[model samples]
Target chain A: MKKNLSEDFSMEDSLEQIIQEKNLVYRPTRLMTGATLSYCPGCGHGTIHRLIMEVVEEMGIQAETIGVSPVGCAVLAYDFMDVDFTEAAHGRAPAVATGIKRLWPDKYVFTYQGDGDLAAIGTAETIHACNRGEQICIFFVNNGIYGMTGGQMAPTTLEGMVSSTTPYGRNVEQMGPPLKITELVAQLAGTYYVSRQSIHKAATVRKAKKAIRKAFEVQKEKKGMAFVEFVSNCNSGWKMTPNEANQWMEDHMFPFYPLGDIKVDGKLVKNVIQDL
Target chain B: MAKVRGAIVVDIERCKGCEVCVVNCPTDVIAMSKDVNSKGYHYAYMEHPDDCTGCTNCAIVCPDGAITVYRIKN
Candidate 1:
């Protein structure tokens, strides 16, 4: 009986029909290459990469944008993103981005750096670039520990946060307090837009995307440095499940690195620190 | 008014089975599969296809960019 059936009854035809009828609401942006991300499962790095690429695609600036990724887990970021990318030395992404932006003048330049690369060894370059009002966007991912190096205590590691080096958790007096690099950079006169965001949840993801778009827009206007900090989670480093890490980030990390704009339109938006 | 229906395609290879989408799905439409992918992770799939609104919440929160959402009006 089945032999008499029409060829249109084939499985492929039905799938084609279904696909033709449905509207594609969301698909992975083409700006991201087919390379599987090196980031661990549930890491925010992939999401941030997607958001930045999506913004560049939506703005029709894919050809005009250049990215600099320095040492750390994201050192191989260029392999995943399709846009033009340059690999900088450890903690030198900001300087590389500055050079690129200065050379091109019209090109949109940005840097992707991790907490260890940005807040620790690269602190001098980060501050100097921002202080000089380099026309570039800085995407800082602060997971609080050296994720790539087996979870060493980073400069931004929260006080009392356990790490491989700090087996007893971070000691504030000895290690000093966790550096609020986002807030510190915001105090620089050159930064035009400085904001901190997280991408753990759907709502926060949307807000983070908006912040990234704003940063790019600020760059397009030839404004001073636009710094965006993403307070992310390092599940592997933290020894927690992906979901548990996000929840822990909410409960602990958010209190110290609150998500919001510290500066806007070349002016300080709010005093993030009461004492300082 | 026609009823709106939504569906999703999970790229099995790309999904890392992190369960971020499972927790973010508003309709409870997604769940980790008992079967494992090539990477040995329990990837996410639509367990309740009829309930999905194509809100894109799961896709938005997906760290691996493995899920693509589609919607149709009946």
Candidate 2:
């Protein structure tokens, strides 16, 4: 039986012989470590992480890039990304990134933050960093809920959205309207480039990649702050399948938080979505 | 002129069976495996391998970055 099995194996080609290096089209960037991501399946955090790493690798700035991870689901970003990383206190990524960039003006510094950390706990830090025109990039992932904390309603939670804290859906009357932190930051004179994008579909992923690359380029040019907001989906937190969550995001979230450039090169773009 | 053929290698252990890549493949060449991986998720595989286009759509939408695409002109 052992001799027969060995003979059968010899008849089939090995995997290495089947897949040649020259035929490769796309592979994960080496900037990402081999560690298995901790994010739930279908969560946008993984895609966003890969995009950022791809940008860093493509631009040949792996050694010069510094990322400040926030206190949310992506706090373990340091584990997944093979780049220089520093952990920030709850909602203080912007402040931490500011200091890092100030000390090394030539290094590219950026913060990876979630809605709970940026729009809620770190509101003051976020505003001040942008207001001061810090030479850093802020990558905000707005999933509308505190995913790391078991689906609690965050400051950016949309109206009528349901979360663990908001059992009956978010009520604007009492809880106050959902904060538009991206637009608010774009209004500040310090921000150089500001854009809102998503990564659910292939086309959108391409656009998000461009936005990330642009943000880093803006920093390399010693420009003022560049803020990119990604309206993402939290499948586990939102209690929906990955596909359903993405569709729901398009149907509801995109209307509330439209995807487009709010500001570019220190100038505000007109025709901003005004309907609340 | 040769026909453009493509293939994809999926990291089974890393895949969570989210089905995002299955839905995004333009050629509809990918499908969920009837067998589950060690993690008990129905991982994706190229059901119609001859139909692949090396578009990179699946890799782009794969949140886990498990899919790698390769192309050959045959």
Give the per-residue lDDT of model 1 (tens digit) for A147-239: 999999999998889999999999999989999988888888999999999999999999999999999999999888999999999999999
**lDDT of candidate 1 over B1-74, digit per residue (tens):** 22326778899999999998988998898999999998898999888765878889999888889988887645
DockQ of 2: 0.44
**Could you give the DockQ of candidate 1?**
0.48
Q: DockQ: which candidate is best?
A: 1
Error of 2 at A138 (Å): 0.5
Q: List the residue pairs that clash in candidate 1.
A: none
- Clash list (residue pairs), candidate 2: none
Per-residue CA lDDT of model 2 for A124-146, tens digit only, reads 99999999999999999999999
Interface RMSD to the true structure, each candidate: 4.5, 5.5
